[model samples]
Target: MTSTRRRGLIDIEIDAQKEKVRKIKEDNRIFDTLETDKTTLDNEKKKWFFTRWFSPTSIDDLEKRIARKEQKIKEGLERTSIDKIHELEERIRILELAKTNRCENVVWMDVPEILDKKIQDDYLEKFRKLPQKIDEQVQSVNITMFGGVGVGKSSFLNTVVTALINNPQRIYRDYKTAPSTTGISKTKAFIPEEIRKKRGQSYREHPTFKDVMHCIVFVIPATTNLYDRDDEALNKIRNLQQRINGPRDVKQVAIVTNIDRIGVPNVDMESVFKYPNVKEFCEDVSKVLEIEIQSVYPIANYHEEQKPTAAKNALALMALWDMFKCGERHIKKKLEIGLNDDQ
Candidate 1:
């Protein structure tokens, strides 16, 4: 489409999207108010609020209204449209072209925002740490995988490890091994703490893992309604987080895995962007999870990559980049410095 035509389309889409989002926000507020009122009702019924006398007619009317209102709100959330998000995405992509014109203003970062140069530099010496390689010194980040069970958490983590290691076979073999479950399980994934004891000539040392632990990876499956998260949604993820009792401010990213199974008929690892809904899925998931849109990613893991494909590697790497950006944003907040677009 011509730039002029695209501009007109974007403006219209933006207005539509804005109105839809406004309604979603209003619905959420209404639900919150209803929930609060219901809690108060419960307390009164239990006589915990020093109310021994209660009117049955008034109680029945209030309970009925609250139940009806709650259902309405639930339906609204499930039906929240992503048309606005897609429109905004198109707008942003078009605007970004201005910055990347002739590649003069394009911005990029080589290292994860949360990593120190000295620590990431260990990748040069440590090569890659193994499940039992307690003697290798390396930087580690704790990734708490959150999603409904079997959302490809273990598969994605294994993909990342394979990409970064000098010996992919070793990582693959370890992933097959039962103990490698330590890297990623239904509950949590981590760089095992079985200390790296030596280096080429000097003893290996791990200095960064302890300080920046608990990076959160929120996973959304392609099989579910991306926004209509009635029983299955970010609230469940948040509850899990509270139960784990990790730091309230741990850096977080959302990974929409199993992209190969999204509504598209020709779903594959390489054709992510061709499916426009995939982009919409990422943005909607981000909003529901309450994180930056840029922090949301849709990726295919190594489930089908017997030897690891380039497409899978690239997808996994970008996912890692965003996770680091989440960590970086937390760091920026610490220093009281604002974040940039590249992050």
Candidate 2:
């Protein structure tokens, strides 16, 4: 071979040897780094396992601790569930009792006979003389007329006043509007003639009965069920009863108005009166008011009276008058009792 070719061959062989050596060194360095990282990871894992699984005094102790915690959680849940169940049961009991009371039916004259005969005789005498006693006086009663809006409450009041002032000879005054924004007006009117002719001059206009409302007439709309506004109506009635001055003022009556709108398939007023809702409403009102409802009168008011054959509206007015008269008699009896007690 020529000298130049031999020299080039020698240089290529040396370069190839040097490249192989460099690649071997690089590979060794990468393996060393990987080994170190693997060792570190293994050590950390072992340490964590030792601390978590082996650090306890014994396996049995660890097991006991776990079981106790589980038991505590279970017991807590059970206690909470039991407490909730008890609360629910108590609530249900109250509701059931209220329901039972609401379903009960009683007659007005069947009120418990607890009075002495002398007291009864005195009451009867006063009751008989009530008309003469109240003659020529303005007797005012404070009434809390309750029902939903559009329940013929205003219509009932108008009917009552109209009935009171039906005679052309008497001058009747319209009551001032109630201050409610909902256009519900509860007013106190002086049925001057009824008061004057029925009660005596000594009985003056008194404030809304401080004790019991002399009369409570629930004016229900005929078209709806008694459960209509049941919760709301019951709440208001309860509140009013609470506001009554004393037990004596707790006179109550139920007037189911709007029979004309009821529009039965084939029923008369007498048949309609047998409706479960009507009976239920009457009973509920009496229970809530804490008084025996003096009566339940069904009333229907259309433009023309002939449309409702039952004279329901007129009868309702008569019911109101009867309630007022009964309440007045009660008041006089109470007053007499007070006088006797004072003596």
How do the predictions measure up, each by TM-score?
0.44, 0.40
Q: In candidate 1, how many Å is residue 305 off?
A: 3.6
Candidate 2 residue-wise lDDT, 1-343, digit = tens: 6555222221343455455445545444444444454555456556657776444344445445445545544665222244554554554444333333322233333222222233333433433344423322324344545665667666666554443334333222332432232122354333223444655553545533232345556665545443445566555555655654364454556676665343421222323333345455556645554556546655544334422222332354446656666566656665555522211
- Candidate 2 weakest ten by summed lDDT: 110-119
Off by over 4 Å in 1: 1-140, 166-214, 227-233, 240-247, 263-268, 328-343
Per-residue alpha-carbon lDDT of candidate 1 for residues 114-207, written as tens digits (9 for 90 to 100): 2222333344233334234221332334456666667777777776666554243444534444355234333354222222433544223533
Candidate 2 global TM-score: 0.40
Computed on alpha carbons, the lDDT of every model, listed in order, comes to 0.54, 0.46
Candidate 1 has its poorest 10 consecutive residues by lDDT at 98-107
